[model samples]
Target: MTIAKGDKIPAGKLRTLTADGPKDITTDEIFAGKTVVLFGLPGAFTPTCSAKHLPGFIEKFDALKAKGVDTIACVSVNDAFVMGAWGKSQDAGDKVLMLADGNADFAKSLGLDADFSAYGMGTRSKRFSLVAKDGVVTEVNVEAQGAFEVSTADHVLGQL
Candidate 1:
């Protein structure tokens, strides 16, 4: 079942890239008592994700933060190393939390997995974004393949 508005985030472990190395953080801890803006992409460094999707967030980080977003995260099925590298490549290293859902467990749990084995990328995350307050989702924007209609920072910022 797709996680919808009003749903509390499921508890799970996700890896975060830190200066000290990778750190395991619980989903609940991250979302608990905070307002977060999170977006998931199929993979790190993919064309759309690099060129536009993530840049949109990096560019508007301050505005989103001003609107009460405690954390702005970009997640993908890639591992911590890959996600870290991609963040550096995009010059977004300091701006966003680049989270790695290496196994797609989090995505699957949210019903956001997209199978792209045909394109040689196994299971991946559907392009989507959400706003959560104190662990409960308040707004969700999931996009169809190759579409960028709803997940833009501008759209979510407006929601806040």
Candidate 2:
């Protein structure tokens, strides 16, 4: 089932590129004892994600942190290398954690996986965002099919 408010984040391993190389990070490692804002997009470097979704979070980093969010993460169905490069290109720096769910395991586990075969993208993540404290969700913002309003940073900020 799709994860919702009050749901604990599922257990999973995601990849991130560190200064040394790709590292494995578990969901628990990320959300444990912290307030996390996790957002997912269809893919990296795609139109909406590149232009708005990701940038919106970067722009609102301080604001989100001010509201007690410990981490703002952008996860996609891409690999570690791509995620790293995309973050660098977007000047994400330390503002957002770029996570790669490579096979969509995390997305599928959340029931937020989307089929984009028509676009030749195969299985990917639907646009969504959620807030969790120590792993239990407090709010979930999932965008409607082909829509982008609900999951934007500004909207999520308002919810906070």
Backbone clashes under 3 angstroms, per model:
0, 0
- Cα displacement (angstroms), candidate 2, residue 43, comes to 0.4
How much is 52 displaced in model 1, in angstroms? 0.4
Model 1 C-alpha RMSD vs. true structure (Å) is 0.9
Each prediction's whole-model lDDT (CA): 0.93, 0.96
Q: Candidate 2 lDDT, tens digit per residue, 41-149?
A: 9999999999999999999999999999999999999999999999999999999999999999999999999999999999999999999999999989899878999
* Model 1: how far residue 2 lies from native, Å: 0.4
Model 2 spans > 4 angstroms off? none
* Shift in Å, residue 150, candidate 2: 0.6
> Could you list the CA RMSD of all candidates, in the order they appear?
0.9, 0.6
